[model samples]
Target: MRWQKQPVHYPYEHVVCYDLETITDQEMQDGSFPPWPRHRPVAGSFLTAEWSPVGYRFKLDTLLCREGREAEFYRKVDSLLPPGGMGVSLNGRNFDNAVLRLQAQRNGLFDLRNIARQAESSRFDVAHLDLLDVFGARPGTSLAELCRALSIPVKTSVTGGDVADLWRSGNVAAVKAYVQEDVIATYILHLHAAAWREGHERQLVLPLADLAIWLEGEPGLRHLLSFATCRPARWARSRAPALRAAAALAEAELRLKREQDEAAFSAR
Candidate 1:
């Protein structure tokens, strides 16, 4: 694993791990400061997970922004996150939050800026945790590199450098998939960091097991199931409670869906 600039600290219970996909402006020259802000966000993905006694439960979703609808993407992100929930990203302090802050300022999005600031800062009241920063700044310490060191299975289908071209070529699904992988990987790392901080090594695999069970019923996230749940078999016996919690959540969701369907049919 890469060296951490600081100990694995911060005790926030709710976390939103996120990643952004961006495209550069056609008119602007290369080599821009605050590189992400110069580019526009075409899509983003966030994984929301809240800690429970059993483990963390994950819900995954993505946001798509057509060419000029960047502000709407920011608004949707702001609306989706819980109040004061911790934000996690790979290089979020420098890249992701920087982009958000700069773009938010341009669009007069003070609320989004505030959220980004809170997530980017390392102050006493900070609500964001940048795993890249936590791992310390060094060459060869990108998300993929860190994942490799920690034995996490990250998506190898595409690289970040390919995202802008892929999106321009109309491969939005690929971009979304890439972003989802990055965010999920970040969340897994976050769980491990939490486990490290709390001195509970078992905390690592339990959340993965729970997230795997939760993903079983989520068709949209099937791609992540195997990658996210790597090496959880050893924890099978200890994962009973987390599995039960996941089952309950899945059942509740299905029941809610049925109720909604029945109500809609009744209206007809």
Candidate 2:
């Protein structure tokens, strides 16, 4: 059976939903329980597919391995992704990307310096759209808080902290389930955001009853919100300006501190 083709040009309409699970050695070294001390320096990472629109599909060309699979993972991801396709993630730029790049270097997998140079030269084709950045940068919002505020159902599965324990305990199945749920939640949120963007609507403030009714009979449809939830006016009224002003102040402070440190070092 042929599926309807999604518009390639409309990025907001076509989203690739994904989630990553990472176990940091630093967290382990902090005297955390269970997997911490035993699994020291063994950071297990997993990437899973949550959902993809009709046109796009999840491509897991690389498999995580004990001997460090950074090179393999990078190659597979590069091969699977389309040129210029946006890399969607919960907070990919800040967390996932940083960790992946660091791991890649530690494992001697790839030359990120070259990648940065290529990006500077406009030789890089892929763009990234981070949901965490969007939601966090959104006035007065956190992930769980945003979902609650938006009336999107939150998936209460195992948290990231639980992942390391699960892996160390040899419970691979549980870990997969947890990772899958995370991916699904991320995908659902991404879709809701995308729909809002395409429709030029803002703020999600639908009644729970109405949303459930709208989601009925649709598989994996529980993630989407109803029209009643879109209330841009409420959020815009207060949060927008506060976020902007705060960001401006933060930027100014950073700049001033950097200049002061530079001048002090020069004088010395």
Candidate 3:
């Protein structure tokens, strides 16, 4: 795992793309959809990508707390989403962030609550970026649907609606797999959004290629290796490293601005 080192100043140090799976009943006694607070989180998954010397490298992690370990599950997810890194997700601000905050408050996990709060903001330095919001936050579009429109590779073995039934039938592996697939899709979306924001189109292919290549070695995620084949030609792959530097540099600029503001306030 080596590349000819390039002078790449990545803007952000790292990015964590995450998704949550909860077990809400099919319907209440009154036959209504489950309320928001009742969506008990059973599985959490995140893909963390950090800037390396050559480009960004990723690690995929997941947790299942289906029986009764919701607190532990949230804690593990929180540990990866430390402040000062980008937290990217799809439809997270409305659903996932609220669920995580409410559950963390109930479990006395104040740090997790605060992280969830900060992650819901529109600020650049905040840990959260909702792809739905990024892509106009329009009505009727979903992560899978949007990925299809953008031609990003998306796996659809299961849907969030199937999670509860799978868990109930003792198919916990299926639930975990579904959550992981969503997180990976979210990660792929974030890469495109970042590249587009930074105006570095070629930058998109490398991190994705890197992710697909990394998935090859991950026993639990080998099913997603199809993403590896979606990479562009050799020429595009060769130029991608040079293009990724812009997003990294943009983050550096933001950091510098924050420091300058703090220094001015201290001088007064």
Candidate 4:
């Protein structure tokens, strides 16, 4: 919780890792997979790490999916994604993003905002980090497989295929819990990549406190407080003092940028 602020300078504001759960049907089983976007999204969730007193913490959310509520669910998802921040997912380019677009179309909504643009980019683009593309377009390997490859823990008691049965059985809580698990696993994978970038070659569990320290002078912490959009609850009450200090520094820096830009415009 106490580290000298190093020269932090990450490219994006934050890294949000997400995934969607869809309802399946017999056609999916028959491999007669219709043009439908990889099962109708019954639920979606995202997880983004933040600087918390508890070390590096995460803000997690689940967007419940329903027939008439698809658009609303997407809106909630959009609200979490800040511009210039990165979105992370496994096979999201082909499956999850398409699901969002198709549902948005059905609901008479097309303004997907950031997600829409991310979907349009090449998977290698930083707009959205598709792990499948990160590892040489190994499309056949599942996210779980990729996690195993990285030696990161993979926890999922239920598969996406099982979601439809659980929904039909009316076990809504189970489905929600499952979706959260998927997103959390994805978040961990993102962390693994970050560690690797910092020259960590061995697989190891990342400590929450270490996350804060690791991001301390790095680019990851730079944008933690600089985005124009407000990030609610970046830090818990337990860490209010630290959060306030970071916010103050960010505000001053932002003000300086605005003044510099205005002066440049005037001179021009």
CA-lDDT, candidates in order: 0.72, 0.46, 0.73, 0.64
In the range 1-268, model 4's lDDT, one tens digit per residue, is 8888564333333677888888655454566545545467888877776543344555667778776777788788777764677888888888888777777777787787876866776746767878776566565577778666654444446776678889888888878877776675666566556555555422112333333344344553333222111121122223445545776799899999999999999999
Model 4 RMSD vs true structure:
11.7
Question: Alpha carbon lDDT of residue 110, candidate 2?
Answer: 65
Clashes of 1: 0
RMSD of 1: 11.4
Kindly report which residue stretches of model 3 are placed more than 4 angstroms away from their true locations once superposed: 1-11, 26-33, 117-120, 123-125, 231-268
Runs in model 1 deviating more than 4 A are 1-9, 26-34, 53-55, 117-120, 123-126, 232-268
Tens digits of per-residue lDDT for model 1, 81-175: 55667777777776776776677677777776445654557733347777766666552468888787777777669987788789888999999
Predict model 1's lDDT versus the native: 0.72
Cα distance off (Å), candidate 2, residue 157 = 3.2
- 1 against 2, candidate with superior lDDT: 1
Model 2 regions lying over 4 Å from their true place: 1-10, 28-65, 68-70, 111-126, 136-142, 151-154, 200-268
**Candidate 3 per-residue C-alpha lDDT over 1-268 given as tens digits, one digit per residue, 9 for 90 to 100:** 7788554333445778888888775568986657778887888888888877776678878888745676787788778774766777787777787888888888888877446654466534356777787788674478888778766666568876678788889898888878887888778777777777778665576777667667777786777765555543233356656656766788899999999999999999
Q: Which candidate is the best by lDDT?
A: 3
TM-score of each: 0.76, 0.52, 0.77, 0.66
Question: What's the distance in Å from true for residue 107, model 2?
Answer: 2.0
Please report how far candidate 1 places residue 202 from its true position, in Å: 3.5
Per-residue alpha-carbon lDDT of candidate 2 for residues 1-268, written as tens digits (9 for 90 to 100): 9999664343432234445565645453566543322222223222222223221233222233344445666555444433334556665555555555555556675645432322232111235566765454652234566556655444465656677677777776656655555554455466556656556322222211222333344454333333213343233334444544665799899999999999999999
